[model samples]
Target: MWSFVGKKNQQRWLWHAIDHASGKVLAYVLADHTDAALKSLMQLLTPFGIEQFYTDGWGGYARLLDEDQHEVGKHYTQKIERKHLTLRTRIKRLARKTICFSKSEWMHDIVIGLFINRYEFGLPI
Candidate 1:
């Protein structure tokens, strides 16, 4: 998921991964769409012992993930796409044409983190 901080030109990407069966967010990071960012998300998922990865045709995934473990196609990512829709609908700041948006990177990450922690993890904030 992609949103911006201060302006649309300064885009911030939400690098999130969800469980296929449970449809729950596993981990996420707010950063530029770079290999390092994806690497960080992958590291967060390390403890889960991920055996396979379903993803789009992102160059970073191809570079970072092992070929046998990575499957790149839209068909395999339906659950995550649906989750993205839910996120975009619920988070006003994620909307492309929204008046309410994050003015800084710090607040942007925090708000999204809070929402994910509360709703996805069912944690008391």
Candidate 2:
């Protein structure tokens, strides 16, 4: 449950990675959707090994899951997708069509990461 928020006028991208099982966010970075960002995420999760992953049909995820046992499909990722909805509701920053309270793409990613870590994973932060 990690993603970047790119505003229509923003220049930077927000990167985040969340643990699905415990809902803990692992890392957050402000970068483009380049190989470096993907690599950084992989490195952050490298110690965990090839755990089961569930993602939508995002091309970036395809490359990230190349070495891991990743599962991609609408049905397979229903839980995460639902989680995203929950996240959007809980975090006003992610709500659609908000103008006054907009987060920088980088901060949005980091905030989501923190939300996942604290709420989803039950982490005491």
Candidate 3:
């Protein structure tokens, strides 16, 4: 999902991993849309023993992910896409055309992280 900090032009990307069966976000990284950001998410998921990755045809996924284990298509990505929609509904900052935007990257990450921790991880708020 995409959002902005300080200004609409400053695009920030939310990259996350979810359990295929449960639809729970396992880990997430908030950064620009780049391979380094994807790498950070991959590192966080290192202990999960993920055998396959279903992703959109993002160039970073193609470059970094193992070809055999990665499948780039809409078919296998519905759950996560739906999850993103739900996030947009719940978080005003995630909405595309809204005045509710973060003033800084720190605030943006904190709000998103807290939301994910409470809802996705089932942690006490």
**Residue-by-residue lDDT tens digits, candidate 3, 15-111:** 9998999888889999998889999999999999999999888788989999999998888788898988888889988885567678889988888
For residues 24-113, could you state the per-residue lDDT of candidate 1 as single tens digits?
A: 889988899999999899999999998999988888989999999999888778888887888888998887656777888898899888
How does each model score on lDDT?
Answer: 0.88, 0.62, 0.87
Model 1 misplaced regions, further than 4 Å: none
Query: Residue pairs in steric clash, candidate 3?
Result: none
Clashes counted in candidate 3 amount to: 0
TM-score of each: 0.93, 0.61, 0.92
Q: For all candidates, what are the clash counts?
A: 0, 1, 0
Candidate achieving the largest TM-score = 1
Report the C-alpha lDDT of model 2 over 47-92, residue by residue, as the tens digit.
7764776656668777657645777776555555666688778877
lDDT-sorted candidate list, best first: 1, 3, 2
